[model samples]
Target: MSDRIIQSNKEELYASCIKRKMEGWRLAQICAVTINDGFEMSYTFVKDSDMDTLRICLKEDEPISSITQIYPCAFLQENEAAELFGVHIENITMDYKHKLYRIEADTPFKAKEDA
Candidate 1:
């Protein structure tokens, strides 16, 4: 395993996606922040013990990548996030298994209309 890291601004994040694809690295996790100006997204790369971690950040209304094409495990992470944080994950082929909660609405953070 080798270590690789790249830091990019909002406009350069697409290049980061291409780099992740070229390296065949999977996505370990994704975190985002909702601010008055915009949203900040951070995609964490799946790293091996010897491989260095890659963290890419950007502020976009909606951003996406196809790291799933290289690493299939990423779909689960993406799907869970989509349901939790309301981001759209493209190219997901299977049902999203919610390992975090027992039973919840499509949007876990959404307050039930009847509630």
Candidate 2:
């Protein structure tokens, strides 16, 4: 199926997730990328042969809500995004407390300050 994208915001994150779950969609993957000075993310869902992506953007330090309540499997990717990209995702079901990885840099994917 052709990929479809939905522009979303922080306020609509949870509600949209619940709606998708009720519509027989399952969380397929959570992906993220660094934007100019922030983050852009996609929460992909699947049902039968269809796929939909709910996308959102956020500032570098903006605290984003977690969807672990609706999709418990989301904690893994959510933690990875928060720990690596400094996405500030809060209320993760299985929060790794930024210890998901054993790397030296706190936010390795984030741009380093000029030393």
RMSD (CA, Å), each prediction: 5.5, 1.2
Query: With candidate 1 superimposed using the best TM-score fit, by how many Å does residue 102's alpha carbon deviate from the native?
Result: 4.6
Clashing pairs in 1: 3-52
Q: Give the Cα-based TM-score of candidate 1 against the true structure.
A: 0.52
| Local distance difference test, each candidate | 0.54, 0.91
Report the C-alpha lDDT of model 2 over 50-77, residue by residue, as the tens digit: 8989999988888889999999999999
Mark the regions of model 1 whose C-alpha exceeds 4 Å error after superposition: 1-15, 24-26, 46-63, 93-102, 110-115
Cα error, residue 53 of model 1, in Å, equals 6.8
25 in model 2: Cα distance from truth in Å?
0.4
**Candidate 2: lDDT over CA atoms?**
0.91
Question: Candidate 2 — worst ten consecutive residues by lDDT sum?
Answer: 106-115
TM-score versus the correct structure, for each prediction: 0.52, 0.93
